[model samples]
Target: MTDILDAAVERAGLPVHWSWRIEVRPRRRTLGLDVLPDGSIVIAVPRQTTPEDVTGVLRERRLWLAKAVRRREALAAEHPAKELVNGEGFTYLGRHYRLLLVDEQTAPVRLRGGWLRLRGDAGAADIVDWYRVRGRHWLIEKVRSWAGRVGVEPPEVLVRDLSTRWGLRTKDRSLAFHWASMQLSPDLLDLVVVHELIHLLVPRHDDEFRQRLLVALPEAVVLESKLHDEGRRVWMGAVRAAL
Candidate 1:
């Protein structure tokens, strides 16, 4: 199956530079193309689908695939990695703070005196825990405000590593946000909160959803574009090895 898909993609004249793979889905009914955050491409197909069909879909969406891949590549290039050293920068609620190693502290990490103070023995996990703790506290209030405006009951909010997603609305109506989102500015973070709240009333990103979102956030389009640009620079827990 893999060889067949590879042959099909090659025959379709798609760019060879792309890192791509094929996945057979037993329950899928149609072909799906996914460009992941790290610039890898996934071609999902039903078990009964032919290589010819795969080639046709690839050919049809060639331009779109190229654009998506390029965007992912650009974002990946800009993704930030931090070193756990004195004077190293970190962001919270869009404000930049320098990391300061402290000999002794009550906690593993704390943001005080405009500095992200980390215990000398601590590492990236401590910083991540700080983000999660602070993000959860901040998001809870923002979620309540947005939920009230959207006229829906506020769901339980959690701040954790969401991988490729900034926010998620689960089937149980719970909302979870990426801890990295705490690095975004307050306005942008509000956009994330409002986005999930709107999803509670409208499940899909259709015309109705857009209308509702615009009504709730007049600057939704601009903020979304900014989020895309700024989100790329957020540190997703990658750390430089100590020299």
Candidate 2:
């Protein structure tokens, strides 16, 4: 359906640069715009939807799409592409560490003297994998700490590179967290863990849920607002680059 979407974009005269992919799925009930981590768009619709229908929504949301593009471009400018070379910086635990490529290091990644002393042969993917490995352990520990305080047993915690969420709680009470959570400050990370652990008792973001969340962690709203403003600036594109 690329031709259909392309034709619609031309007809609408939208100045979008990314190639928007039109996907007709079997179970989709409504239309939505998805900005991929790699700065692409996906228009997901129901199986039998027409290009005309998609075009109408696109035109209607022209302003929103424009804002999305501006936001993406701003982020791109703030966090330009990394060459993964020596002296390049990466974030860990909300602190910046400059990379120092070494020849005889055994570990793929390590921190020394305010520097991320990485093996000269290792690449960006290797650093991301290292973060993922360390993130799993940190998230598990945080989950256990918060769950204990909330009178809930810790569920199965796993870390993966998520595109748009910091953490998710499944129906079975198991939890999954984005590896990018490791880059957030400790307070923000605590908020994320507390937010998800509260999901065990309250499934929705209702008033009761908010109250309970505050009872567990008082600074939820304030910190979450900051996180919204600070946003998930997963800049180096490690999440998508490794994928």
Candidate 3:
């Protein structure tokens, strides 16, 4: 079913040696483990799978998963949590701006006096809306620019809140980007743009795909390493206090 059946699984006396939580999915052909960006693991299993099989798989991969989990935890600790309050640092286009709340402002969000100004007592919604709007606009422009360089038609940008991916390219040639991409510096963000645009030419990440990417962005490898480092700071565990 979904992640909700975890209690039943535990009650059934399955092994819980795995440090992270698991989601058992029946009616699926594959038994897979996804390490989410929020530092959680989702284990998907087929209907015919046994608790013994799942436990075996987990045990076999225990060391690798443990290392992965530690990395995720370190990243989370690096970014921590961001609270929307006066003088709190918020990023926009590689620069940090203090969030200044003003009561008399008409707009819910905007840039005023170099601060990410909010009208009144704002929560997650207002901040998310503002980031989404900016991310969408910026990514659309990047898609257009990078597509032309890649010799492909520009794809329509779809901004989304994604936990498992930074960017995705669909069969329809449209590009989907995580909204937090806006927090990245322009150079780092360009790497994501170039990556998705190249996917338009080569769907799979095979040799030819990498060759083409290098041709367009010669420093792809270095840029990728930097992106991973900077991205950790951009990815706070959760925005809302409740989350």
Name the best candidate (by TM-score). 1
Compose the digit string of candidate 2's lDDT tens values, residues 28-76.
8888788764466778888767778777888898888877877876766
Identify the runs in model 2 with alpha carbons over 4 angstroms from their true place: 1-72, 78-80, 236-243
Regions of model 1 farther than 4 Å from truth: 1-76
lDDT of 1 by residue, 1-243 (tens): 778878988888877688888898989999999998778999999998888999999999999999999998886678866889899999999999999999999999999999999999899988999999989999999999888888899899988999989999987999999999999999999889989998888899999999988999999999999999899899999776668
Instruction: Encode model 3's per-residue lDDT on 51-140: one tens digit a residue.
Output: 666666766766777777778767668776676667877887788899887888776889767898977766657776777887899888
Rate residue 227 of model 1 by lDDT. Answer: 99
- Per-prediction count of colliding residue pairs? 0, 0, 0
lDDT (0 to 1) per candidate: 0.91, 0.79, 0.76
True-structure RMSD, every candidate: 8.5, 7.5, 8.2
**Candidate no. 3 TM-score:** 0.68
List the candidates' TM-scores in order: 0.70, 0.68, 0.68
- Least accurate stretch of 10 residues (summed lDDT) in model 1? 74-83
